[model samples]
Target: MKEYLKASSLDEALNLLSKDSQLKVLAGGTDLMVQKHAGSLSDVRFLDINALPSLKNINEKDWGIAIGALTTYRQILNSDLVLAEFPLLAQAARETASVAIQNRGTLGGNIVNASPAGDSLPVLLVYNALLELQTQKEKRNIAYTDFHQGYKKMDLRSGELLTQILLPKGNTWDRSYFKKVGTRKAQSISKVVMAALLKMNGETIEDVRIALGSIAAFPLRCRFLEDFLKGQQLPLLKREELDRLIEQNICPMDDIRSTKEYRLQIVKNLVWDFLKA
Candidate 1:
């Protein structure tokens, strides 16, 4: 009843998309297949692009590092460039589901899925990542901050496919941390997650970036908190001010996984612990 086509190349994929308005791109099929099994998608035309060579590379360029959208979590965990430059991303990848899932789930899929509890989203936000989208006509790059539109929504348009993720290549983060609180140690959705990047001069924080997930409608960057932390010494990080700031900035909703009150407390504790560390 449904048509499944394996794209022979990137061009073929784009052409298929141009022809079939209802066609969906399939990467790892980790999330898409789940939606399929749930009957959320019906009479779907799947354009399989997992084998498209243009979307399967991890390249280091003058602009920064370019990670192909099709790159799997397992590959990211094993990439030397990822380990040396963006270890938090690799750490997030390692925290994703099981080894089997990691081997199949792709970075692009995680991003496009745009789940509030996605582990990698916070890390990507911390890195100020950029996404490359391509179509039969042209290609464009969108900042990660501008990519997510709303709950389970993105800036992606019809006939366009996400091709790569670009992360700046540098040592801006002298100290970094990532933590996720889930129902279980592994294979569970996060109730609250945090990713922090700090650039310090001695004990003074010259720069800082903090991002959180599962505590909001979508992954969020705490620029206000980061601005407050900059040029401040770690020892001078007052708990009262920190708590007040978090309470003022974040208003997490009560969901099936966690309560709003619980999420707020976790945010306070995590920020306090991170500063102390």
Candidate 2:
């Protein structure tokens, strides 16, 4: 590392970020340290914000819940508010690495890392999470869906830091489903991950949101599928139509973990199972 600096406060961190465009913010060090050791970050300057107390809180807002960026996976799993109101997120957090990694890997780190295989990302998409970004001079909020532009790319600006994630409350979902497919269930990275929220009116679908990861360049919401599924009767939903929609919605690739054909088939099966249940 060219430089390593620890920030004691949010203001100082923002100020430092404003000065050095190349300065990388280090939170949990889970991803950063790995990169550092791999020599990928050899010349990067690091600004450690682990000591900033303001970025490590979770609070309930009138509209929803506000989770600080520095909140760890363990913290999310332990949070009663999170568990009760957003169990899908809690489930994702629980399925994240082992206990030690969960304790040390912060949600902020996960979001900023922008890996398509990230466990929480599909859940965040289905939940319609919002992000709050801060700079020395200003603060702004953006929809989490719009945050990722491509693989390993984001809408985050040079001097801004992601501060909080806002998740709107959903008390009316008839059913919610989250599933991750990997070599091993607990510790392995996902080959395909899917999360969906559905609201049913008797047998007809009133509303639906679906998101998927590791089937595209970045984790993405299945907007076309959601639009098609809305107002469709579940029992009458044709498997051919569903398969077509699913294929149109995702762009899976043959990778080291799994083949594109397998990922496509698994996601279709998962969605079918969720709908049937």
Candidate 3:
């Protein structure tokens, strides 16, 4: 690293990023520091933004919930607003490693890291989370589903930084569920994870959103499966039909943690289990 700087405000951070495209912004340092210890960090400058108080707030907005980019996992787990309204997100927050790592892992960092196995990505995708990005010149909102481009890749531009996460009308979800299949329960990264939000009218499904992680290059919504389940009664949802739908929609790849076949099978089971439960 050529230099280290700390931004006192969001504008300061944007100014620095605009001037130096190679400057890496560090929020919690949980992921960045790991890369640094592993000698993976390239020669670049560091801009620490942990002190920016504007980026650590959690407030309810007319759109929905506004989670400042620097909000930590532990904070999310303990937040009454988050737990009551976005239980799936809070559940994902609780399952992120242990208390120690959660204290240092920011929500924005997890999204920006764009890890295939990231526990929060699927939940955000299911809720249709929106990202607030800012630069010295402009500010914009991008859908979370569109933010991720590929493995460890995102739509973030050179002179921009992620500012906040907006959950638009997500609290209106009827029933939300999140499940992660991992080596253990807590500390291990997920091999296959699913997040579902369902709104049912009596026995018929009114609206549904489903997202899966560690089954593709990036966490993605199961739109085909969602479309098939909507307006259908629970009795009409057959296991074999759901199984076929999942197999046709998802594209999983074999990796160090699990096999492609295993991920595919478990994803099918998880979707069924979530609906039944």
What is the lDDT, from 0 to 100, of the residue 4 in candidate 3?
Answer: 86
Model 3: per-residue Cα lDDT over 230-266, one tens digit each: 9999877899988988788776989999999999999
Residue range 1-277, candidate 1, lDDT tens digits: 3589899899899898888858888999999999999998787888899998888788888767999999999999999988988999999999999999999999999999899989999999999899999889999998999999789888988899999999987666777899999889989999999999888899999888999999877999999999899899887778998899889988997999999999999999988877787
C-alpha lDDT of all candidate models, in order: 0.91, 0.91, 0.90
Say which candidate scores most in lDDT. Answer: 2
TM-score, cand. 2 vs. native: 0.97
Estimated TM-score per prediction?
0.97, 0.97, 0.97
Error at 231, model 2, angstroms: 0.8
Residue 277 CA error for candidate 3 (Å)?
0.8
Candidate 3 weakest lDDT stretch, 10 residues: 167-176
Measured with C-alpha atoms, the lDDT of residue 182 in candidate 3 is 98
